[model samples]
Target: MKKNILLIGGSYGIGLELVKQLSEDYSVYVASRTSEGLEGTSATHITFDANTDSLDITALPNEIHGFAYCPGSINLKPFKMMSLDTFESDMQLNFFNMVKIVKDTLPLMTAGGAIVLFSTVAVGSGMPYHTSVAAAKGAVEGFAKALAAEYAPNIRVNVIAPSLVNTPLAKRLLSNDKKIEMMSQRHPLKRIGEVEDIANTAAFLLCEKSSWITGQVIGVDGGMSTLNLS
Candidate 1:
């Protein structure tokens, strides 16, 4: 039987890549605000708005083999200039929304199933102008670890922290050639991350190949989180 996987925000970016890759072996259900970019794919598209609406659990299957929450925020600002609303909004989008989706979908996950959530390299490396997003993703890392512990022997939970991936959500940061080159130079790998860089790791964790791994935050950030080869 084909495994069923749910991707909460798979309309684009890393999520879309996951849908494309995983669809070759699994039945992928993608939920996001719009169905654009998901056309002509084997994956099923379900309309969802994580910011203004709650997850529609009724559309999910009774036995889910994997779940990935890919929605996130990138509110980069100086700590002193950041507003409380900015912090709160980031938390809502990155952490709280994921929590709600996981809680509602837990019942549908089969034993030994996997859950993947996204964080950021900033959470561990402490980059400048990442206060809001870092704070939100930091909570996600903590939540993923705790949830992994609580759901042990049944469900597996993990997080992927990536640095400056080239995605639509990050277009502004990499809009110009100069900005792209500058961002690329910051990483030890000397290149910005690609969606597949994170998506492939996510797919591994969701499969039985990583069945023994749980409660961990794996960095897919091109060695940016642990290296400083300046």
Candidate 2:
């Protein structure tokens, strides 16, 4: 039987790649604000907006084998210039919304199910101008660990923290050749990440290969978080 999975924010970026990979074997349902009609032949696309509302999981399959929350922001600003609202907005989008979605869908994800959430390398190794995003993603990291422990022997929850990736959201950061070169050099691997890099890790976490792993914040970055040579 094909496993049923729900992918929130799956229109583009890492989420879209996930839909593509997972759809090869498992049945995938994509929900996103901008996703109109289904783009690929494998997955089913549905209209959804995480910032304003929650998904209607009641209409979904009872056996939800996998779930992933992929909506996030790169709101990097100086601490002196940041406002309380900015922090709140990031928290709402990155952390709180995911909690709501997971809470709503937990019933369907019985034992053996897996939930994958996105984080950033900034959460583990802090960088300048990352206070807001790091705080938000830090909460997600902490939540994943706690939830994994609480739901032990049943559902599995894990996180993937990636470094700079070539995505529409990251276009501004890597708009020019100079910026791309500089960013690539910062990582130990000497190359910035591609969407498929993170997508493949997500596929592993959702598959039976990683069945024993939970509450892990796997770094998909190009050795940015761990290794450094200067």
Deviating ranges (above 4 Å) for candidate 2: 36-38
Reference-based TM-score of each model: 0.98, 0.97
Q: State each model's CA lDDT, in order.
A: 0.92, 0.90
> Per-residue alpha-carbon lDDT of model 2 for 1-230, expressed as tens digits?
89999988878888888888888799898878887435645787777788886687765877899999999999888999988899999999999999999999898896899999999999999899999999999999999999999998798999999999999889999999999999999999999999999999999998879999998999999999999798
- Give the runs in model 1 whose Cα sits over 4 Å from its true position: none
lDDT of 1 by residue, 96-136 (tens): 88888888889899998999999999899878899999999
Model 2, residue 158: distance off in Å is 0.8
Output the TM-score of candidate 2: 0.97
Clashing residue pairs in candidate 2 (N, C-alpha, C atoms within 3 angstroms): none
The C-alpha RMSD of each candidate to the native structure, in angstroms, is 0.8, 1.2
How displaced is residue 5 in candidate 1, in Å? 0.3
